[model samples]
Target chain A: MRDVYVIGAGTTRFGELWERSFRDIGIEAGIKAINDSGITGNDIDALYIGNMSAGAFINQEHVGALIADYVGLAGSLHIPATRVEAAGASGALAFKEAYLSISSGMYDIVVVGGAEKMTDIGDEMANYITSMAIDQEWETVFGATYASLQAMMARAHMERYGTTREQLGMVSVINHRHGALNPDAQFQREIKLETVLKSGYVAEPLRVFDMAPLSDGAAALVLASGDVARKYTDRPVKVKAIGQASDTISLHDRREICTMDSTVYAAKRAYDMAGMGPEDIDVAEVYDSSTIAEIMAIEDLGFFPKGEGGKAVEDEKIALGGEIPINTSGGLKARGHPVGATGVAQIVEIVKQLRGDADRRQVKDAKIGLAHAVGGSGATAVVSILEAEI
Target chain B: MNMPRFWREKQGRYNLVGNRCTNCGTYYFPKRDICPKCHRKSIGKMEEVRFKGTGKVVSWTIVHDAHPDYKDMRPYIMAIIELEEGPRLTGQIVDCSLDEIHTGMRVRDTFRKLSEDGKDGVIFYGYKFRPVKE
Candidate 1:
């Protein structure tokens, strides 16, 4: 297989996008990525869209066809457009498919995008739809919300690893601080750790601040073969490796609730394929659906040893200028998690940092970056490694 | 959300029934056709097994934010119970307060009403856990 590279990336400002339809925001992000890559619609070979639930959110399905037609890539162009759904990891899975297509020599110029319009359905229905990602027959039927599931994991982590509430609060504090520097971030204001601590409990041990808001947005990336990547941009972020894995859907089915085995497996595969260890990664973005999740992800991804992730955050090791900066785009916590859009958004942030385009939140001398996306309670995880073309 | 889907799992939901892989002695809750450990080899070797309702709370959460269906049950205690039969399952910890639930606390299953679709709709019943009072 040949090498793949990200030529361009773009994302919409994440928040309650009241006016834009799902297809509209998706087209906007795609067009921006095309423009950023200096490529026209005619240059695209195929399109892949990552979407969790446009059907439930907007009562629309066949989103790939809708987006393709809206972006003027359908009919005459008749591009092979497909939609990938793995709940929250939809975006990363789309990227992985696009990468494989390009690497297989079947397609050279591919556009991978993720979009979700969650606010349209109202919070209650939207949340109910989101809960479909869990075990529908068992977990969801018993009233297990995502926050409550993660809260249980947090409780287990606290009980076994001695992870403190203060440590859990630190994840939100750091991410919000970075979000304050990001122009497109939803909550672009710094919040205190005390704010997270004193926030009303969404689930015991997990506060409202611990959760990522229901957001509506889109993100897109233009990928090309390594040979053709530099033709689009002088500096292309090379896709060193891509890895994905899945586990039992229910949290109870997992051998250990505190550890996301999917993340560990996926990250291990990505690192092996990249021939690089965790220490080689200069920057990273791990899924932070909740503050506790960020802690678990860092450890599961091998960034910090098991049970040490919390203390590492407490020591500012995950801060922007600290030992290995994480979630510089403010993460899902403050950057806004539009479910499907999040995986691609994480990639967009990494590409910006690699290109030296992220002004204030840029990590110094960033050479390699990793983006991790999780689908439903750690059942699915996708890890991608990107290196600056030196 | 369909009646048949719930009805189909009534055996397990009501009696804590599961399947044990006779070949490997591994147990599974919500019985599966094939054992995850032995895969296709253990397909015909699976046997029905019932767990003793008794267990310990492995982890739990007092859910304040809940689904639309469970809005009335806000701040309800949900927990992961490690059953005596070596299988784990999720259920609400009833007959207890938030302050009373913790990891390692002993508990046992009790049949209770899960939720109703509407005021006049089907009232789904399933097993829930309560503190194993000494």
Candidate 2:
């Protein structure tokens, strides 16, 4: 296969988008990406839309076709719309597939994005939609939701690795600080660690602050073959590698809970394919579905030693200018995880950092970036390694 | 659908019966088709082993919001309790206040209904724990 590069990326502000429909929101971002890439709608060979629970949230399915139709690319060309679904990793997986198809020379250019209009359904209905990620047969079958699942995982991590509640709070405080600087972040206010610690519980170990808010947004990325990347933009973030893996659907079926094996396996593969290690990565965008998930990703991705991830945050090791900057884009904690849009949003942040477009959140002299997205209870994981140059 | 039968199958077993991989010594809760640790198909029949239920709270959160089906039970404590045997389990914290929970606090096992799928569906019951009183 040939190489693929990201030439343009765009995302709308993430928050409670009360007015925009899913199609309109998606079209806006897609058009922005197309404009940024200097490519018209005709230049796109295929479209990949990552969406989760459009049926549940909006009472609409066939989102891929809906996006294609709304964007005015349906009839003239066989713009086959492929809808990707892997819980929260839907967008990242969509990007991954589009990148592969382009790299393989099947498509010259691919427009990839995700959209979610969760706020329309109300929080209660939205919560049910998000709960689809868990084991419906056993876990959710028993009425346990993702909050309860993460709470259990948090409890287990603390017990097994001596992970402190304070450490978990550190993730929230740091992300909120970064979120304060993020113009598009939903929760753009810096919060104190004490505040998080004292926050009301959402689950035993996960506080309200520890969780990402219910968000509605859309994000888009334009991918082209390496040969055609220069025709689109002067600066192309090369897609070095894309790695994805899945653990058992049932949390109880997994071999270990404390360690997210899916993340470790996927990250390892991505790093190996990119011919780099954690030390070579200058910036990272990890899935912080909850604060504890972010902490676990830090260790699982090999940024820090086992059991030292929480402490690393306390030492300011994950700050914007620290040893390894993580989630400079405010992360899911503050960035607002819009489920379907979150993974694509992650890629957008990394692309911005690599293009030197991120003003305050920029990591100095950043060369390589990695984005990690995980599904429920660590059952599914996708790791993408991107570089400034091939 | 019967509460007693479901409880008997889970809590009545006494032991937190799970699958243990003889090849790699990794234990799996709720059993597994194959040993994930060793990737070996030849796995011994792991038996029911009662945990001290006494483990440390790995992490926890108090859920203020609840699903529509569970709205009445909002603001409940859910936790991941790491058993001394090295497996972590998710359960509700009973007989303790939200303030009583802390990371690494010692806990002992109890069984309770996590949730019911529907009125006619199963009333799921499983092991949970509370802080072990000194």
Candidate 3:
């Protein structure tokens, strides 16, 4: 296989963007990435679009063609536009497909992106769309919302690991602090641990502050073979490893609620493929759909021992200027999780950090970075490791 | 309205038993036609097993917001109770305040009607748990 590198990355400010249509948001990010890569539309060999719920959210489908056509890539005869849907990991799965296409010499350059138009729908509708990842047969029938599922995991973790409400609160605070520095983050203001703790309960143990808001946004990346990458940019973030895993879809089916075995499996595979462990990375972006999810990812990624993830946050081990700064982009918690876009957005953050362009949230001399994206109640997981050099 | 095939099974007195392949030992709740572990379609019969519904609270959250059908059910405690059978089940925790529910607290199952198939239809009865009496 040939080496694959990220030549350019772009993402819109994540939030309830009511004015931006899904096509516009996707095209905006796509155009920005193409421009940043200093490549014309003609240089792109194929396109992959990750969208979770356009059909359910906007009553629209064929989003890959919509995005490509909106960007004027389809005017001229073009390659097929592959639409990837793996719940929230939809974006990462798209990126993985594009990355492999280039690495396998099937394509010299590929455009991989994800977009979600969430705010147009009411919160109720949005929640339903997001709930599509859960087991329709067993879990959803019982009125199990994603928040409820996370709540279940949170309670389990609390019991097994002694993860406290305060520690979970710390995750929101730390991410918001970093998000305060992120211009494109949905939430730009810093939140105190106290505020998170005092927030009204959305689910027991988890407050309103614990969950990510309904967001509408898009993120795009340009991937090219190592040879093509050198021509497009001076600093290309190497795609060292990518791994995806799945557990039982129904939360009830899983043997353990607190243990995200899929994420742990994916992370271990990524680390093994990269020939390094989580400690070898200078920075990380974990799926912080909720403060609890971030803590779970931190532990699953091996940044901390099992059950100590919450303690890692409480001890300031995951904060900026700490032992390992996690989610410098504010993460999904503070950054706003536009479901489909979150995974690609995480990659954009990692690429920016590896390229030393993150400005305020930049991890110093960050040579390697990791991104983990989880789909629906820890059912599907994807882990990618990026390095500065081959 | 007719229940979904999965929910239809719950109406039986089987207690919604899950089957485990004795050979590979991969377990499936609500039972499975084939073993996920060994891929043997000739799976063992699902044994009628009942959980004390008594299990430790693995995790829980009180949902202040709920789907419209459950607007009345807002602020209800939805929790996962890890059964001794090794499957973690999702259910509402009744008969307890939000503060009273904690991870690792023992819970007992109460078979209850979770929702109506609508007003004039089948009442969907499922298992929810309450804090086990000390």
How does each model score on TM-score? 0.99, 0.85, 0.92
Superposed on the true chain A, the predicted chain A of model 2 yields a TM-score of 0.98
**Best-matching candidate per lDDT:** 1
Worst 10 residues of 3 chain A by lDDT: A135-144
Q: What does the i-RMS of model 3 come to?
A: 2.2
> For candidate 1 chain B, which ten residues in a row score worst on lDDT?
B66-75
Q: Please, what are the lDDT tens digits per residue for candidate 2 over residues A1-390?
A: 899999989998899988888888899899888888999887889999988789989899999999999889996776888999888999999999898888777999999988888899777778878988886644553446887777767777787777898989989899988888899998889988889989887766678888888998999999999889998788899999999999988665566767899999999999899999999999999999888788889999999997888889888899888999899989998989989989999999999998888998888888899999987778889999998862
Q: Model 2 Cα displacement at B82 (Å)?
A: 8.7
Best by DockQ: 1
Provide C-alpha RMSD values for all models, in order: 0.8, 4.2, 2.6
Off by over 4 Å in 2: B1-64, B74-134
- The local distance difference test score of each candidate is 0.93, 0.82, 0.84
Ranking by DockQ: 1, 3, 2
Local accuracy of candidate 3 as per-residue lDDT tens digits, A280-371: 98899999888889888998889999889988899988887899889999999888898899999999999999999999888888999999
Which pairs of residues collide in model 3?
A: A155-B58, A155-B59, A155-B60, A156-B58, A156-B59, A203-B62, A204-B61, A204-B62
Worst 10 residues of 2 chain A by lDDT: A135-144
Give each prediction's DockQ, rounded to 2 decimals: 0.85, 0.35, 0.57
Please give the distance, in angstroms, between residue B60's alpha carbon in candidate 2 and its true position after superposition: 6.3
The first chain of model 1 has a TM-score of 0.99
**Ordered list by TM-score, greatest first:** 1, 3, 2
